[model samples]
Target chain A: MTLLSFFNYWVVIILMMVGFYCVIARGNMVKKIMGLNLFQTSVFILFVSAGKIVGGSTPILRDGVEVYSNPLPHVIVLTAIVVGVAITAVGLALAVRIQEAYGTIEDDHLRDDFDEEDD
Target chain B: MSPNELFDLLILALLIVCALAIARTKDLAAAVILFSVYSFALCLLWVHRGAPDVAMTEAAVGAGVTAVLFFYTLTRTGRREK
Candidate 1:
């Protein structure tokens, strides 16, 4: 069997690991958020790709067009994208407040700030 | 391999490169910009896969709204990682 048979899944897995590593390894809060975004986007890609069929037509119905791709994933991803935006907004707001409190968004500095506050 | 398969692989390669760039950048602003490029690539991948609706959502939310929101927050919170 050729690698193409399963390489698409491998791509998504690599993205997942990259994002997960960024979230765990990065000290910057914004980088962490972007990592989360990348992770989520990879999953979205996986889902949308799963819904594709070889030689499938676009979901739109028209004359002489058959074998339409799955529309369910599209609908699901639409809602998911909105939720992701909401989550990002809230996360950023929290980051802003954290910045105001500690004057830095670095995880290391935040720890230092917390320790200093305990004095 | 057909042209379609080759194009898909090309986009996949670009996505991986962009993801690494975003993850490796120390500057938060640069990472955010790279992320916009990443999202645009993702939208293209989806469009290539025959999912225009998902592609549209990815473009609008991922590239447009997310980038703007990050910039707005960055301007207030400052841009450096440390």
Candidate 2:
């Protein structure tokens, strides 16, 4: 396929990489969570866009509407978005707790704290 | 290309830009706001792609609830990346 045909997928790939980089490169706990959110969003976009069919309308039953874009992916993405929200909530809660306990949320700082305790 | 394809391209461009900006920014609050913009762009793309239901959910959960959650956490934590 030509570049235009696969452009959407290419963008998704870039976004995934960007998110992954943020997760690995950042020491801040909240930043990592944001990165994870970006990664999940890219996946959601991938599935939803893949479900589109050229010249087709929404997956609703309407008179004189011939083709409908695949509904399954939309349904799947909907569930994924909810799951993502749950994940974000839990992750943020954990981050807050980490801050409260350690007084800092940077990964390296937390590591140093653990090292001092082990001594 | 048709208008639909052009719209898709524009939205995808916004997604890439937002993702990169979020990654690059050192300010936690700015990153969160950029992410909200990102979510809105994705929501718009979903609507244009014939998935209005998914669009609404993304708008509400992604842009609304998620940003609020992030800001709440930021208030507890600090806004600086370092």
Candidate 3:
């Protein structure tokens, strides 16, 4: 309805597109993982922003404070952050292994190397 | 616009720059550094929006742990994109 609200979602979408472009256009495995990280972070921002109330304070309770922001997204995002870290760790480990196996982590090189091995 | 919106606009601008920087860089290390900056902006955005828990998590995981992990991987692999 309003420009501000629309901008919020638009920013997330734009960020996601950037990450997606990195994932698809880039050839380096590490860069792909970074792109994936960027993508996930954008989604987290979108969810948290959606849970925020215009006139609300943090979820902490107080004697006279009302209209606290939603805590569900916060909890969900906390869990997601841990999962994201785990994923990143595993991805980096895989990148390291890919380099050791192929002598290079570039996607094209890896594909070529794997094909050579198959032949 | 209000102060909060103004801050959000600034962070949004920095985020765009960081994303573009990460995308265009051919140096893997430089890209990781840009990603660190991007994550810091994300953390600040969360703090500005009153989500301290998420902010902390973003700082620790996105900026801290993830960066370290990538650098470790970079050590094992070469740093150039090609």
Candidate 4:
């Protein structure tokens, strides 16, 4: 593979790992959502990267440029962005409710609070 | 290998390290910050992949909106050990 292509792939892989790590390691509910957002963002990167052509131009109607980057990926990413925003809104709402009910957002703390209630 | 490839490898290694740190961190705030970094890295990835629009959206939604939401939630809740 060319140097650029290799580089692009590496970036996507790295971001994916970081994002996954955030979701799994954080005790705060909000942090987990942040991690989830990162993970999804990485996926978006992957899709866009996949659509790239080394010599392609923008997918606009033009006279001379014969090669153009895939427009499908652009459309997909736009939709994904909207979806990501909606999910973030929902996640925030849930976090708000969780805070109201338990008075804490930390996973460990929330678990303990629940345990106390159970007892 | 080319210099670009080496740089890519270095960045990938850094990303892995950051991800592991995020997973291992005990502090919720730290985790959130790490997650934001991850999103930024992903945005870079999108740019590298030649999709500036996707990268832009990722930066705006993933790094900006999501981080704000998480921070707001974190602040609203108490941090005292239960």
Instruction: Name the top lDDT candidate.
Output: 2
Off by over 4 Å in 4: A2-18, B1-18, B30-34, B78-82
Error of 1 at B37 (Å): 0.7
Best by DockQ: 2
Candidate 1 has which clashing residue pairs, if any? Answer: none
Model 2: which residue pairs collide?
A: none
Per-residue lDDT of B1-82 in model 4, one digit per residue for the tens?
6664565566556666666776666666776687678667766655655567777887887788777777776677643222
Per-model DockQ against the true two-chain complex: 0.80, 0.90, 0.82, 0.44
Tens digits of per-residue lDDT, candidate 3, A13-85, equal: 9899999999999999899998998898889889898898887888887798888789899999899889988
Q: What are the per-residue Cα lDDT tens digits for candidate 1 across A15-90?
A: 9999998889998887888888889888888888888887787898789987888989888888888888998999
Residues A4-113 of candidate 4: C-alpha lDDT, one tens digit per residue: 67766676677677667667866767667766765776677567767877657667676998987887988898898899889888988998898898777778887888
Ranking by TM-score: 2, 3, 1, 4
User: Which ten-residue region of model 2 chain B has the weakest summed lDDT?
Assistant: B1-10
| Regions of candidate 2 where Cα sits further than 4 Å from its true position | none
lDDT of 2 by residue, A90-116 (tens): 999999999999999999999999999
User: In candidate 2 chain A, where is summed lDDT lowest over 10 consecutive residues?
Assistant: A1-10
Residue pairs with colliding backbones in model 3 are: none
Which scores greater on TM-score, model 2 or model 3? 2
